[model samples]
Target: MPRFAANLSMLYTELDFLDRFAAAARDGFQAVEFLFPYAFAPEELAARLHENQLQQVLFNAPPGDWDAGERGLACLPGREVEFRAGIHQALAFAQALTCSRIHVMAGVVPSNQRPEDCHSTYLENLRYAAAAAAWQGVQIMIEPINERDMPGYFLNRQAQAHALLDEIGSPHVMVQMDLYHLQVSEGDLASKIRRYLAGGRIGHIQVAGVPERHEPDVGELNYRYLFQLLDQLGYPAWIGCEYRPARGQRPHATSEGLGWLQAWL
Candidate 1:
C-alpha cells in the first residue's frame, strides 16, 4: 500500500495549525507535511507530533518574504546569504521534527537577470544545501511548479529539474515530484512515473486534483491507477496530500473529502 501524509498547510484548514496534527491522526494519517514551519517553535511542533504519533516527513525551506510575492531564494543571484541561512533554519526544524526531506523552492527570475544566471545560482545554492543537509542525514528536494500557477518561476519542468539534479549529482539531494503540477505541465503521467521513480531520484511524491487543486478523486487524473503504480514500483516514501479540501470552508471539509483516501486505506 502507498503511505499517505496529510498536508497540514492545505488540509484541515478548519482547525488551528497546531491542532491539525490530531485531526490528521484521527483521520488515520501516519505522517504529515506542510509548506513551512518557521512561524512556530520547533519544540511546540514536536510536542504535537509526539502526542499525535505522527511523523513529520517533509516541509519546505523558507521562501523569501512570502507576502511580498517572492516564491523562493535558491535561484536568485546576490541572495546566496539569505538562501543559505534559510537552508540551515530548515535543517534545524527537520532535526526537531525528525523530518528527513526539505523542499527548496527556486525563486522567480527577475526581468533584469538572465535565466542562465539564475540557473547557475540555483545549482550553486543547492550544492551548498546538499552538503549541509547530508551531514544531518537529511535530503534536500527541488520541485517544478506550473508556469500557469507561478509565472516567471525559474523551475517549471520535470526534465529541467532532473537535468539540474544530474549536474548537482548529490545523493543527499532529490526531486519533490508533485503530480498535480506534473499533470498540469506534462500530461504523460504514467510514463513519467515509470521513468523517474525507477531512477530512485524521486525522494517524495505529492498529489492534488489537476487544474482544480482539490481532493485526488475530484481531479481529471486517475489517482487510483497512479497509486497502484506507486505501489508496484515499491515507492517507499510518504505521498503528501497537498490539496485543498473540496468542501471549501465548511467545518470538517478535509474529513468530508477524504472518501477518496478511504478506498486506498
Candidate 2:
C-alpha cells in the first residue's frame, strides 16, 4: 500500500509549526511534509516528530522571500551564496528529523533573462546541491511551478523538469512531479507519470485538484484514477496532499476528498 503524507503547510494553517506533526498524526496521517521549516528550531522540531512517531518525507530549502514574490532563485546568477545558506539551514533540520528528501525551488526568471542562461545556472546549482545532499543520504528534488500561479517562474512543465534533471546527471537530483501544477501547465497527468516512472526520473509526488487548486474531488482531476495508476506502477513513496481547503476549515475537510483512496489501500 502507498503511504499518504499530508503537507501541513497548506492543510492546517490553523496550527502552529510544531503542532502540525501532532495534528497530522491525530488525523491519521503516518507521515508529513512541508514547504519550508526555517523558522522553527531543529532540535525542537525533532522532539515533536519523535513524540508523534511521524516520518518527515519532504521539506523545502528556504526561498529568499516567499511573501515578497521572490519565490526562489536556485538558478539566478550571483545568488549561489544565498542558495548554499538555504541548503545548510535545511540540512540541519533534515539531519535532526532524519528526512531523506528536500525540494529545491526554482525561482522565477526576470522578463529580460534568457532561458539558456537560466538553464545553465540551474544545472550548476543542482549539481552542487545534489552533492551536498548525497552526503546525508538525502535526495534533492526540483519542482516546476505552473505559470498561472507564478507568472514568470522557470520550469513550468514536466518535460522541462526532466530535461533539467537529465542535464544535472545525478541520481541524487530528481524531479518533483506535482500533479496540480502539471494539470494547469500540461494535461495528461497519468501519461506524464508513466513516462517519468518508466525513466526513473521522479523523486517525489504532490497532488491537488486542478482549476480550483483545492481538495481532489472539488476540482477537475480524477485523483481516484490517478492513485490507481500510481499503484499500477508500484510506486512506494508518499503521495503528498499539497492543497488548500476551500475555506480556513480543518484539514479533515480535505481528508473527505480522499475517501476513494481508502478503497485502493
Tell me each candidate's TM-score.
Answer: 0.99, 0.94
Residue-level lDDT of model 2, residues 1-265, one tens digit each, is 6667889888877667677788778767888898888887888878888899888999999888888888787878778899988888888888998999999888989677787888888888889899999999999989888999989888788888887777899999988888999989999888889988898878788988789878777788888888889988988788898988776566456455556445644
| RMSD to the hidden true structure, all candidates | 0.7, 1.8
TM-score between model 2 and native: 0.94
The model with the greatest TM-score is: 1
RMSD to the native, candidate 1? 0.7
lDDT of 1 at 48: 97
Query: Which 10-residue window of candidate 1 scores lowest in summed lDDT?
Result: 244-253
Q: Give a tens-digit lDDT track for model 1, residues 100-215.
A: 99999999898999888988899999999999999999999999999999999999999999999999989998999999999999889999999999888999999999879999
Off by over 4 Å in 2: 250-265
Q: What TM-score should be assigned to candidate 1? A: 0.99
